[model samples]
Target: MKESITRYQFISLIILFEFGSSIIVGLGFEAKQNAWLFILLSMAGGLILYGLFTRFVSFYPDTPFPQVIQILAGPVIGYILVWGYILYFLYISARVLRDFTILISQTILHETPLFAVSLLFMIVVGFACYLGIEVIARSGELFLPYVLLMGGLFLMFVFIMDLPKIERLEPFFNIGVKELLSLVFPRGVSFPFGELIVFAVIFPHLEHPLNSFRYGVIGILISGIILLIISVTILMVLGPTIAMNSTVPLLDTISLVNIQGIIQRMDPIVIIIMVVTGFFKITIFFYGGVTMLQYLFKLPRRKSKGLIGFIGLLVMTVSMLISENIAEHLKEGLEIVPLYVHVPMQMIVPSLLLLLLFIRKRKIQKK
Candidate 1:
């Protein structure tokens, strides 16, 4: 059976995927006292980069990056590029799995074995992948609206808890233009913005390839705005120092909501939202990894699913090995190595591919 997913479903997955990992806790650390400002700046830059990427995709409608590289750079060079991307995707999927497992163990199920949590997540995600992209996209579509609504309610409650402090957001540029710029455009035009590179892999699967640009841009914008609002809420409610120090600022903030003691202890609801959002996010990375492997080795049609599951199990194991402490993982991920690893992968390589494609197109026209 030829299964298909609509463009909206894909868009929802992308949105949820981006929001999953760091939207709540990431700002708690990196952005700190000026979390909202940092997010706004990051979003603005992210949108610009995303626009550039989408334009590149639209330039060659239905052609994924791997194919584009092959045509422009020739098979030898293209295969190398594809191989690098495959490895990158595998690494990212592993890291995200580990991070999510850590969160669940620390907060919700303290008694659960880490391996058990990782295995259960793999089983569920593996099943989704086995069902194919269409099934995964449908799940994203079904859950996205509800997740958004729940997120909205959470924000509303945050506002109710601390309305007066909303003004604390004023004096917007007080963090110094340099610091703000650093947070937004860190490491010379790279950072989180470069993450839009994954769209290149999935472009062929988009229902409306032409409109992928629009939808992709919209997805980043929506997610960015939500992140900005979330950062602001956490800052106003928890204050700068505490919010920065908190492992789960949103959860901490939610725990403070009393509503006459009846509506208290809503942290569980936030955890539910985390699980849902994280699932979609991790699935996208996992899908990207699997697809890359299939394309790289030219695996048999049906065997790709089984192979991908085995690969995912390895990824989970690697995640466990990467760190003994959550703080160390965050330190390495944020401060030590992301700029070095992600920047070249996300920005440098793709930009080179685009350039090569343009040069090849010119040569063909000249002939």
Candidate 2:
């Protein structure tokens, strides 16, 4: 209920949130060499979509996204719509946790069970949620600079170690146009970009709320550049073939950071980037969902504290049960999530809601 976050903090939060899982996954691998191209295009699509979503917010000043939904649609249908977003926020928070847990188990803690890794991570995530968004946004402002600095250094090392082959990106349209375009449609946009909807929940908390849209756009722009740099770096270093095939292309790309034998075994750099960004990412989504719950159920923050813990527990459990294995998880993320959940909840529903907003405005004008 406090509008405490500054515009710069909002930008930092978006950079970290968009860069969270996105840096590790969804690197435009499917498009191969053209992955970065698709990402750039996807970003443009996302910006326009985001602009529209924010416009919806501008209509209802001093309100959260859920209240906007309530205004556009009546309470009954609006609550149903808001519930869809609540589930989405919960799903993505858990999914990001699952990704971190999986990566840790596969790499550092090979002997650790998925549950244990998740358990440890959730403890930190839950504690952050307890502190709430102001603390989380402050943490982002403090840490995102390092993430970006480290990311820049990593990119520089890749280029300095050995120049990536220009030929790797040859045959420009490597994949058929349809195939490449398809990869960007809902999946690419939703994962990092469309997911900006969650920010609407956080946006209402911004002290200079009028500057919300500006910072949000800047956030997307900065994150897009980062994501683009990462995708292209992967393509240039690993080439399209290996980059496309590797499950953790960014890590794999970082693994190649052999700076004249001075900076080998740079796995820790990747881990640092992942953990810091992932923390802010999870915290924001978790907080957003919790705040929405308080609004939806009309619960006080004091009363909702227990509910937050319960939902965090639910996130851990659901993440564990999401898929039998990482392969299935990736497949579901690529095919199912975009097609069904994100497209409807993020893109489609928002469009419908915008139309409804217009209709409501006209009715009011007549009054």
Question: TM-score: which candidate is best?
Answer: 2
**In candidate 1, which residue ranges exceed 4 Å CA deviation?**
1-3, 28-33, 187-192
Cα TM-score per model? 0.93, 0.96
Question: Could you tell me which residue pairs clash in candidate 1?
Answer: none
C-alpha displacement of 44 in model 2, angstroms? 0.7
lDDT per residue (tens digit) for residues 207-296 in model 2: 877677788889899899878878877888788878877888888888877766887988888888988888878888888788889898
Worst 10 residues of 2 by lDDT: 22-31
Instruction: Report the Cα lDDT for candidate 1.
Output: 0.74
Clashes of 1: 0
- Model 2: per-residue Cα lDDT at residue 157: 80
**In terms of lDDT, which candidate is strongest?**
2
For each candidate, how many residue pairs have backbone atoms clashing (under 3 Å)?
0, 0
Q: For model 2, name the residue pairs that clash.
A: none
